[model samples]
Target chain A: MKNALLSIEDTVALIASRAILFVSGPEHLLRSLPRGNWIGGTTSYFMTPEGGASREDRLFCTTFDDAVDARMAILPPNGLSGLIEHRFAHGFTCIVTPAFSTTLQRYAVDGPALPGLYNQPVFGWVAGVHLDRVGQDVPMVFDGATGAASADGLAALWVALPETAEVDLDIVNLFAPGDGESITFPEGGFDVTNCLIGGVPTNLAHYIVARGVDTTLPLVADYAGAMVNVSFQTVDAENGRVRFYAPVVPGTIYRLARTVADYGAAYAEGAREGSAADMLSCNCILNYRYAELEGRPTGGFVGPVTFGEFAYILLNQTLSRLSVRHALAA
Target chain B: MPDGGLLPSVDDQLWARLLTGELDPDIKTLATRLIITRLRIEVAKDSTVLPTAVQELRRFFVENKFAHRDLAAITGF
Candidate 1:
């Protein structure tokens, strides 16, 4: 089976029992398991059918039928971005870790680029929950060795599937245009380091104040015909900068739209297009808390509630998922 | 200076010494800072008990010696 949301018992049982395995859940429980055929990050949220919104410390797992050989690597903070494209240049990869993680903190600003992963279906999430890991668990990707999640490290799980299996990456965005106003950075980029708009490199907080844009609402852009978006993280009034969970691509034109849509319909259709066969999926914490998805499901997609997501880039306020299906007829 | 075990009470000694009758502006400021630092330490220990801490401060004020009027105007003293 490509994917299944196994119970706590079944997950622990299935780990070493399977030929190849990858898992996600809380740090303490994941660390408790014996070292075997699995790797996971710390998180308690998942997407299930009752509109899939819940903090379940259970595992969403993947098990390949045939004995699969995998190459694993630890991408340190400095080199993670460059390393991904090179390592998984040809194979399928499953990356898991928490956000503001030292390994990921650089990318929070660097706008990490993987040389040739545009077509490679690289999927993962920035995993962690409200700082129970503060004094206890270290928010991290662990492999059972008294690991520290924050300061210590992060992990990338790479698995090469069978020839028949092809990967498809999907994003479930539930926002339609509301109060549309086309926006852009006319001259340069707006990042944590230099927030600019209309060619003036000022802090994002300044620009937002100057423009009176609601920082809570996301900005969407038309990449060809597809509407891609960037979500806000913190409005650093002190720093005069606004940090986003994802990067605002340097030269793209964006529009400040009041997002208005239904989550249930968005995830259901997106997941179905991938044949409703997701091995890994994560909804953003923004969508979870702000969208009030605590007990409700998002149609039929389910996984962890992540701090951020990577559908080849850092994403916010979106559910990004992956599946391995047979190549559709050409 | 104390010969016995009774160290002079910080509150009692301070009020007895200066800034009493019509409270000078400078000494009042120093007194305000002294009370604030001690209150801040207790609050910082755990902010969850903030309301209870405030009540405790009010109780201490009620039990203590002569001082400024308008306890309602006092934000945290």
Candidate 2:
């Protein structure tokens, strides 16, 4: 039998359980959790092994804005160092949960209205497990940026052991354009890439070229229109334990399109426009990046289903666009 | 200043006065706004029932005035 460590499933389950507890309980549930901007737009709960009753031990519950502000407020004159020191002494653990709202739709050339679908509010939740023992006062550097403030933000769990932990990171670019095609730019003040994606006829070739750079290219900006997808991942290896974290569920696919006539229109109206590309919505997975960079490890990895869906959508869109462009140019 | 005893109607202001010492100016402002908003909502629900509640609340505030008036001056409102 294969040796089983902490599977992504186990981590997600823990996060989900904590999230449920937070949402179902008192309003003050968010006040006590580890505070930060990444935890924004989400509810959070923090508990320790020795904490008292749920009500008494529960730390805090608040909106993302409040959470960020609170976290910012606690920073000391030397930045994150003070906060890290406090965390070392407290034996802290935290859970962050996010609530997303929007609909994803896919378009087909044959139909006036393309086949559409909606994804319900998917919550991104993660648990924090502290591996370090309390009382060893270690000198740690504190970078002020909200995401880079702590080790947990950069990777999963900071184990303060007798010896320092060594970790390796792999950053894989998942999108790129196909071979032999080139997109040249018309020199001037114009942002060629943005122009092509945003609706400038002269910039079409540039968009194609930009897509060529990434093996995981997005759908052709002209054919598919504009899309936004969030992508991020972090792997933390420490003390014989490897923790995988996906800020957003990689398998959860969300199709999104521009709802407004133009970029300005969309911004003014505060919504989307055009047709959806699977996985076009902001990938919650990036939250893991924010957490990891901040030295906080949001416990749990993105489930396989979500990861598969994200990868498929990313690959399909890029390859499909390249194929179409190749045929059109030919 | 009696511990845990119900103060007379005239002494209701003592609660606010006392609370002022324990809370900072910003906290005082937030607490006041919270209390006022709650009172306003209650008053809106039943205007007739609010006068008593408002009087009691005001009295509590007056009696419990902070040691430093600077703390009471901070108004989130």
Candidate 3:
């Protein structure tokens, strides 16, 4: 695999070479690319070798050189399950859903119920606009097969791998459930007005304010042995409501994450365990902002700083990496 | 041992229990929900994921050690 930030001319040439690619760049640059075996999402922030930087002219591209066959598609509205049917039996799938779209919300809430979701290695991110232009600019994903861009469609690339190739996908999360109340919601959703705090009904927004809880820290839950996070988006104390980047599922016990004193050190420690080469990875935009990653290196981890990371399911405030390797012959 | 073969009878019992939310009381947990959902499709049809489903369930059952006698008899985990 080859991962790098390239000029529009170089990216165009790479696409013309018919290379299977996962591209991330500014919306205009992504829209300029020619049709080929590639899929793209809008994002200007990237973790480059030099350091984290937001560039509009260059595109971050990861080419899957070992993939023998590839198919790219844009899923229709409320059609996330279409990805399951499009999976390659022996390979992995990369998906890019536009941020704040109905498809993204649906996937956040209903993705766990999607059949065959765990049968294959599925990973990707929610495309996002620059932080400076949050509401003024919209996130978009591209189906490179048709040179088409959609603001709300879920774009996916399904690649068929050779027998010798193996793909593994996982996440690097720095947060763990803090020693606090066992929080649970009555229903699963992105917005919440009421929740059970240690089995006592409490207003979520009021609880956050009353306890002086740091909104930057996400609510963490143990999914099997994995620590999943639902990052806080906004707190409307007057209305007794709160919003989260990912949905909080019903019956899932949660606690606010333990504080990390140093973000750079934690990520660096996590990066040391990752296989930097031959890996297609992405970090959360929240991490980029909270850690002040601009011009700072995350050890060897590099890719787009996405709005949200996908490892089987949508994740928040985490790093998702997918590595493809070729097995040695006996 | 083929990838797409019909799941063995023992696994079918586990799959049935999973469908009925008997595999784990906390069925709403992300992992349990995913495991059950996957089995729902792979069990209903012969697919390459059946073997994977069986292995994952065995691993989960072994780790959690669900106290269901029927599950223990079916999986021996």
lDDT of 3 by residue, A19-47 (tens): 99999999989888989999999998998
The parts of candidate 3 lying over 4 Å away from their true place are: A260-274, B1-77
Global CA lDDT computed for model 2:
0.23
Give me the TM-scores of chain B across the candidates.
0.40, 0.45, 0.39
Error of 1 at A85 (Å): 6.8
Q: iRMS value of model 2?
A: 22.9
Q: How large is the C-alpha RMSD of every model relative to the true structure?
A: 25.0, 25.8, 6.3
Interface DockQ of candidate 2: 0.01
Which lDDT value does model 1 have at A229?
62
TM-score of each: 0.68, 0.20, 0.84
Compared with the real two-chain complex, what DockQ does model 1 have?
A: 0.01
What are the per-residue Cα lDDT tens digits for candidate 2 across A109-162?
111111110000112122221113112321121121133322122111111111
List the global CA lDDT of all models.
0.57, 0.23, 0.80
Chain A: TM-score in each model: 0.81, 0.22, 0.96
Model 1, A83-161: lDDT tens per residue?
Answer: 4554533456667766666666555445333333343456777877653444454566864323333433456667666
